[model samples]
Target: MDNFIGEIRLAGFGFPPKGWALCNGQLLPVNQNQALFSLLGTAYGGNGITTFGLPNLQTRVPLGMGQQGGVNYPWGQAGGEAAHALTTAEMPAHTHALTGSAGGATALGPANNLLATPAAGALYGTGTDVSLASSSVGPSGSGQPHQNMPPYLVINYIIALVGIYPSRS
Candidate 1:
C-alpha cells in the first residue's frame, strides 16, 4: 500500500492544540511532546548574527530585554554582577538636592543662599565625596556608581501552532 494515500486529519482546529500529534509519512501518530520541544534550540529566523531567537521549551518564559551584541543596546553592564529583578522596595528613591555655587570666602546670609555652605561645621545634602578619574567621563571609561549591574535576560522565542493531536489514553 502507498503511504501517501493514507488520510491525515487534523485533530483540532484554530489554535495549536496542546500535545498535538502529526503523523510521519507512514500515517502513524507522531510523538507530539517530542516534536514540539524539538522545534526549540533551532533558530526560528533572524539575521543569523547577534540577533536570533532562543530555544523556548518552558511554558512560562519572561519576554523582556533583548539587545543585539554588536548594536548600541542599553544593557546595564557586561560580565558584571547578577541582580535579580528589583522589587518595589529596591527601586531608586527620589530626592531633590539644593544646587548652587558661591565664589566668595564669606557665607551668604539669606534665603537665596539656602544651598550655600553657611559655616565650616554646617553641611546640608552632604555625604561622602565621590572620586572621579579624568577618564571616567565621556566614552573613555565607566560612568558613576562604577560597579557591575545585575545580569539581564532577553526573551525572543515564541511557539505558536494550530490543530491538535488525539490523546493516547
Candidate 2:
C-alpha cells in the first residue's frame, strides 16, 4: 500500500524500508527531501531554510494532537518525566498518635491518678497519660528515577520519506 508523506509506522527491523526514514530526529537537507520538508516544516526541529528534522520517537511515545477530555496537548509539544519524586505537599495530611506511661507506681507514688492530676508530691504515674505528637513522615526511597514507562515491546518508528502528499478533505 502507498503511504502518505510524513506518515509514521512501527517496524521490528533496525533499518527503514525503501521510501521510509527512521524517526530518530535526524536532520535532512531541504533540497534533497523537499516533499517531506514541505509537510513537516520545523515543527519537530530544524533551521527551516536548509534543513528539516524528522520526528524523534526515541524513548518517547506519540500522543494525539489537540485537546481531549479537557486536556490540551498541542502538536509538537513534548513534556513528561521518566520518574517523579513526590513532595510533602503532595502527600495526604495525617498525624501520628503516641501513648505511653510517664512513670511506674514506684516512682510516682501510685498509679491511681492520671498525669494531669498526679498525686500531691509525685511527678507522674502509670495512668491515663496519652502523649499526642504530630510530625511529617521521613522521606523514603533511594531517590532514584524509577522506570515511568509502561510495559512495552521494543520497536522502531519510521516515517515515509517519499509518498503521495495528503490533502485536507
Candidate 3:
C-alpha cells in the first residue's frame, strides 16, 4: 500500500526584532511579521515559486544578498507595512524539506528529498558560511530569493490552508 502525505508546510511565521544580519558584506534580518509572511506565501505558493516575485521587490534596499541574486520583488502595501515580498532566501532555511507526495528516501536528514538543500549550484546566503538552513518558516533576501531551493508543497494542502481563512471569514 502506497500512502502520501498531502503537504508538509512550514507555516506560522513570527520572530523577534533580532534585526538583520550581515553576510558577504550585506545586512539582512531574520525576524519578520505576519503580513510579510502572508505575501511570501502568496508570491511563493500562489504565483508559483518558479515565477511572480513579491510586490515591493523594487524598494528592497538589498542589505546583503547581492552576491546571491538580489532582485527585489514588490507587493501592494497597506497601512505602514511596506508591500514587499519577503525574499524566500531570508527564511530560516529549509532544515528538513520534503521530497514529494510519496515521501522519498530517509537519509537521516530531511524526509522529503525534494526540498532539501542543494549539493552544488548557486550557493547563496550572506557569506562563505555555507550551512544547512531550516524550512520551518524563515525569511528571504532583499532583492531576490536566496537560492532556487525548489520549494516543495502539495497543492491540495495549500488550498486547504487558505480555505481555512475563507471559511472563517
lDDT of 1 by residue, 1-169 (tens): 2111111233334332342222311121123323332332123332332232333222222333466666543322223233344444655876656576564325556655545545565555778998888676523323334333445443322233232422346
Best by TM-score: 2
| Model 3 lDDT, full chain set | 0.31
lDDT of each: 0.35, 0.83, 0.31
TM-score of each: 0.20, 0.72, 0.13
Best by lDDT: 2
How far in Å is the alpha carbon of 27 misplaced in model 2?
A: 0.5
Candidate 3's C-alpha runs over 4 A off are 1-99, 103-106, 115-136, 143-169
Off by over 4 Å in 1: 1-32, 42-69, 72-108, 113-158, 161-169
Steric overlap count per candidate = 4, 0, 38
Full ranking by lDDT: 2, 1, 3
